[model samples]
Every structure is written in structure tokens, then in C-alpha cells.
Target: MKKVTWKIQYDSTPLIHRHCKKCGKKTRFKSSDQFRINAQRQYLDIWLIYKCTKCNTTWNATIFSRISPQALTSEQLNQFQENDQALAKNYAFDFDLLRKNGAEYELPAFSIVGDDIGTGESAEVKLISEYILPIKVSTLLRKKLHLSQKSFRELVENGRIKDASGQNLLKSKLNGETTIIFLP
Candidate 1:
């Protein structure tokens, strides 16, 4: 069987959703790509800053709260103090941290990077993502293959497309990596 691999490439960081006191409603917040550090004697606190897209209000997402400065290496501490872009990006994409802060997030725009399979070709396809995302498998497949809902549904129902484990692909969400098989 032919093999193909697809990688999901995100275009930007996700926007966070939470109540904005200034806006008096829930609003989307975009990351400012900056970090704020506070040192209190022996402890240090770190936060990633975000701004309300609609009102420009600021919110700080906690990274480390009242932790010892010695807990992190000098390089790590310096990265946080200097607002490293990569470090900031890692924190910005952390959905668990966002959920813990009572906030929701929208997924960033993404493109599937892979070669296309021709009609009636048997193939094993692997889908991979760098981050754990809550994207629907059906949506990704349809977008990459340029298939309509009806066409995609028909293919699934007729056993042309299926997950490697035979899970219902239509109802499955992609977390990190998934394998699918296309029957000729």
C-alpha cells in the first residue's frame, strides 16, 4: 500500500476567550507575545500577557505563581525575563493552562502539508500535529481532499475511508496523531 503523511501547520497563536471587565462581556484576547516577571524576595512569578481584541484590555495568564527563583535554570529564567518569542509561543498554545484560568480558546488557522492521493488508490495516511488541538478529523480530511459533506459521508459509509482502529472517523477529533486507511 502507498503511504502518505500530513502535518498540520498553524499560522498563528490561538485567541483566548474570557470575560473582559472593561468590555462588560466575554471577548477574545490576542497574545501580546510578552512576559511579565515579578520577584518577591526568594520567589518569582511569571505571566504571559494578552490583550482584548475588541477593547484592548490586558490580561495576564499565569505561568509560574510564587515559585522559587532557583527552581528554574539561569537560561530558563533569563528566557522568561527577556520575553523569548519561542517560550512565549509555547505558553500561548497551552490549552490546559488556558482552561485552568477559566478561559476558552479558538484554534489558529492551519494548513495540511502532504501529498494527495489519487482516485481508487489504496494508501495508509498519517496525520500529525505539533500541538494537541481540538480539531475534527472529518473537517481536516474534507478540507485537504476538497470533498463535500455528502461526498465525504458517502466514502465513509461505503467503507472507502476508515480509521486504523475502525473508530468512527466522522465523530472523532484529532488530538495529536491519527492513522487512516483508504481502501481502493
Candidate 2:
């Protein structure tokens, strides 16, 4: 079978959802791409900063709390202190960390990077993601293939499109990597 690969490319960091005391309601917060560090004698506390999109209020997402400065190497600590963009991006995309901080997050904008499948082509397509997002498999396929709900449903029902591992294509959430097969 012919093989194709698609990579998920996020355009922005996730927007955090939580109550903004200043706004008096839940609001989306965008990452400020900055880190705040506090030194308390022998311990250090670190956080990634976020701002309310609607009100510009600030919220700090805890990265490390009351941890010893020695816990991280000098290079790591320097990166945090300098507000490294890549390091900030890594923490900003951490869904589990966001949930642990009592905040919900919306997935950022993304584009699928790959060539489109030809008509009636039989192929194995691998979908890859750098981050474990909550996007659904069906949504990705339908969006990338420009298929309507009815057309996508028909293809799935008729077995013209299916998960390589037998996952329910309509209900499976994309996590890391997934393979789908197209049959002529």
C-alpha cells in the first residue's frame, strides 16, 4: 500500500480556562511566555505567567513550588530565568499540568502538514502529533480531507476508511500517533 504522513503543527499555545476574579467570570488566558522565579532562602519557586485575554489579569501557573535550587542544573535554571521560548512552550502545552493547576484549556489552532490523498487511492496514512492534544480522529480526517459529515460517515460505515489498529474512527481521540488505512 502507498504510505503518507501528516504532522500536526500548532500555531499558538493553548488558552487556559478559569475564573478571572477581576472579570468576575470564567475567561480564557493566553500564555505570556514569561517565567517568574522566587527565591526563599534554600528553596526556589517557579511559575509560568498567563494573562486574561479579555481583561489582561495575570495568573501564574505553578511549575515548581518550594523546590531546592539544586534540584535543577545551572543550565536549566538559567533557561527558566531567561524565559526561554521553547521551555515555555513545553510547559504551556502540558495538558496534565494545566488540569492539575485547576484550569481547563482549549487546543490551539493547528494545520495538518501533508499531501492530500488522490481519488480512489489505497494508502496507509500516519498521523503524528508533537503534543498529546484532545483533538478527535474523525475531526482531523474530515477537516484535512474536506469531507462532509455524511460523506465521512459513509466511508467509515462502508469500511473504505478505518483505523489501522481497529479503533472506532468516529470516537477515537488523537494522542501522539495514529495510523489510518484507506481502501479502494
Candidate 3:
């Protein structure tokens, strides 16, 4: 049988949090799906709003500043006007917006799901992180694969599982193309 290998890639999952000026502490925020728009003569100002999880304080992340109506497509404008939840979820991961507003963020948690059986005695797996943020590979692997500490250590000792780059996967932050070989 051909060796079963997985070329894994994932999108950036941002840990969205903001400091609550009212509560005087860092708090998780949820997308409000609410927009505040203002018409300044011919230009329009738009914001994507978020509310603090604890206190319900509002934070406005600027989507556009003085943008002409002609600049937006009808669909795009309608999405903003209607407060699309899907669009809001995408916006929730906007690190640029969070950084612009001087808000604090954490690394997002991620997991991988796959079938139990691989094609051969060994399989090549690639882990890709779309986010600019670094992820802890060892912990993620342990959690995702449901492996015990002893089993993981044994694999490491026997060199049955190793990074394709020959670097230590345990200490490194997983990003870009990280290839791992799993021995059955």
C-alpha cells in the first residue's frame, strides 16, 4: 500500500481580546454584528463593533474612514449594512485591527482531526499554521492525537516520530511547513 500522508494547512485563528477600560481589566470580546456608519457629505465612515464579555462596553474597529459610496460593491455594502455574522466572524480574527486599537490578544487554540488508520507503517504529516502567531506543537499534538506522555516520550526516544527538518518539535513553535513522520 502507498504511504498515507497528509498535507495539512489551517487558517489563522486569532485570540481576540480587548482591555475593558470600564472594568479596568483584559476581557474577551465578541463580535456584536453591529455597525455604526456616519455620512460626512459624500464619504461614509464605518466601524465593526465588539462588546466586552464581562461589562458590555463597546469597542469600534474602524472598517473604513471616509470611503466613497462608489468604492464599495452593492453586495459588500449590503453585508455591512445588514451586519452579516459570517463576515463578522472573519473580522474577529483581524489582528491588524486589534493591534491598531492597542488591544491584547492570546494565541488561538487549534486541533487536527483525521482517521485512525494510515496507509503504511509510516506516514508523513505536514502541519501548517496560517496565523502569524506561533503555536505549541507538542501540547497541540498531545491533545489532538490523544497520546499519553509516556507514549510520546517513547516515540521520541525511538525516533519513530520526528520533524522533517530534524529540529526538535517539542520546543519549537509550529508555523510554516513543518513535516512530521509517524511510525506505526
Find the candidate with the highest TM-score and give its number.
Answer: 2
Residues 1-184 of candidate 3 have per-residue lDDT tens digits of 2233333333433545767899898788766877778889999998878788788898888888999999999998898889887676556666667778676666554556444434237777666544433455666566656788787777767887778788886776666457777776
Runs off by more than 4 Å, candidate 3: 1-16, 108-111, 117-120, 124-139, 146-184
Task: Give the per-residue lDDT of model 2 (tens digit) for 6-113.
Answer: 999999999999899999999999999999999999999999999999989999999999999889999999999999999999999999899989999998999999
TM-scores for all candidates: the values are 0.86, 0.89, 0.64
**Cα lDDT computed for each candidate against the true fold:** 0.92, 0.95, 0.69
Q: Candidate 1 on 1-184: residue-level lDDT in tens?
A: 9999999999999999889999999999999999999999889889999999998999999999999988999999989988899889888988999888777999899999999999899999999987777778999999999999899999999999999977799999888899999998
Q: Model 3: which residue pairs collide?
A: none
Candidate 1 residue 132 C-alpha distance from true site, Å: 0.5
Ranking by lDDT: 2, 1, 3
Candidate 2, residue 169: lDDT: 98
Residue 97 lDDT in candidate 2: 90
Query: By descending TM-score, how would the candidates be arranged?
Result: 2, 1, 3
